[model samples]
Target: MDPMYQELKEIEHRPYPLQPSPWLMTQVWRDLLFMHYPVSTDIIKSYIPTELELDIFENKAWISMIPLRITNMRARGIPPVPYMNSYLELNVRTYVVYQGIPGIYFFSLDANHPLVVTGARTVTGLPYKHANMSFEKHEETFHYASQRIHTAKKLNVAYQPGHILFEPQEGSIDHWLLERYCMYSFRGGQILRGDIHHDKWKVNRAEAVISTNTLVPFIPGEFIGKPPLLHYSRRRRFFIYPLKEV
Candidate 1:
């Protein structure tokens, strides 16, 4: 048995990931466009951070938490830019919490701010580096930018702001622009993967087996590995389609 497995087996249970609420849906969407998008003479200045205050050139860091789900997946690889592996290798702290409904919302943190959310997905979580609104990937014109666009569409649909105001701050911003928009990536080393000291198990051993084997590759933890004799029941996966938005 693997030592990591032995240690995981010792633990009886783990905590569940936090879920997003209806209010959160309203807030995230409004921020992404009205807050993050850099446009001149914006009315929503109160919500937007100041450029002078943002040390975008200085490499000031912060965290952006994107509350959404993963829709597409691909092996970590490079595109037309060869000789480089393209993964969501941005140096930052990222957390994905199951919304308990359907999708998982991702929270990204860096030296810029504490918790600035950037984007979200509906059918699934964003592919590695796919959700980083600051990356050139987001700016690319021809590629399947569909992921983020789809996510943005979903957000627009979920948006239920009865009186939400979109504006930049009145005064010159004192924080990083990405911090305000939660759209940028970190500039330094990344956090360790195994260091994800989550104590709660999202699925039981039996269920994990079916998940790892059938759909995605199983990430070995402590105990549950071999396939179970019976299939575990699951809830209906919820999705907020972007194309359906008004």
Candidate 2:
């Protein structure tokens, strides 16, 4: 069996929120990095919709900056579209709970693929922006950068993953952040959800040097002056279901 399909067969580690199979889309996430910063709970409350509650750990809310390469993207039973199959992406996201189910709420997603940006905005109502981006790996480190076309919000970072990769233990912060299976969006006064699924992340501690990070203009740059918690994963094959109102 294909490794991706083999992943789907092992579901004991997955949470209960997954929508049933016949998932509408699939993609491969490569060289993913997660940079997490802690923020005051009060600071995040105003941004989340009233329909959703902030999902905090300990007593602090978290914001994660994710940089990744997306590939082999295609709808169920469809071949990969030539110009749309691959792209570099940067995401600003936070955690939220909707109707007792914990999930992610993206502040904004910037990608280099024009078709993807337009399609995501139109179809999922996600805040997707087109950007000029570059990605390359030197030795063992990944040098990733992106600058949004509309607003020159740029992010440049170089990171390398440690050799010891392991699954995040349940109840650990890594599990809390990376194990989420659904994403929520607020548009036109309504909340929508897109459910996603993949196997548990096998990640290693990552070392990163961030040179520029004004990707989130709404938040002050000094807010993350302190180093963030970092984790790196080589790849994951993901399946996504349709977006529906919650």
Model 2 C-alpha lDDT per residue in residues 20-97, reported as the tens digit of each score: 656888899999999888877777788778789999988878889999999999888778889889999998999999
Listed in order, each prediction's TM-score against the native is 0.17, 0.94
lDDT of 1 by residue, 71-148 (tens): 122121212223221222212222111112111112321111112223322222222333332212122111111123
Residue 153 CA error for candidate 1 (Å)? Answer: 26
Write down the TM-score for model 2: 0.94
Model 2 per-residue lDDT at 196: 86
- Model 1 accuracy (lDDT, Cα): 0.20
Name the top lDDT candidate: 2
Worst 10 residues of 1 by lDDT: 26-35
Cα error of candidate 1 at position 192, Å: 22
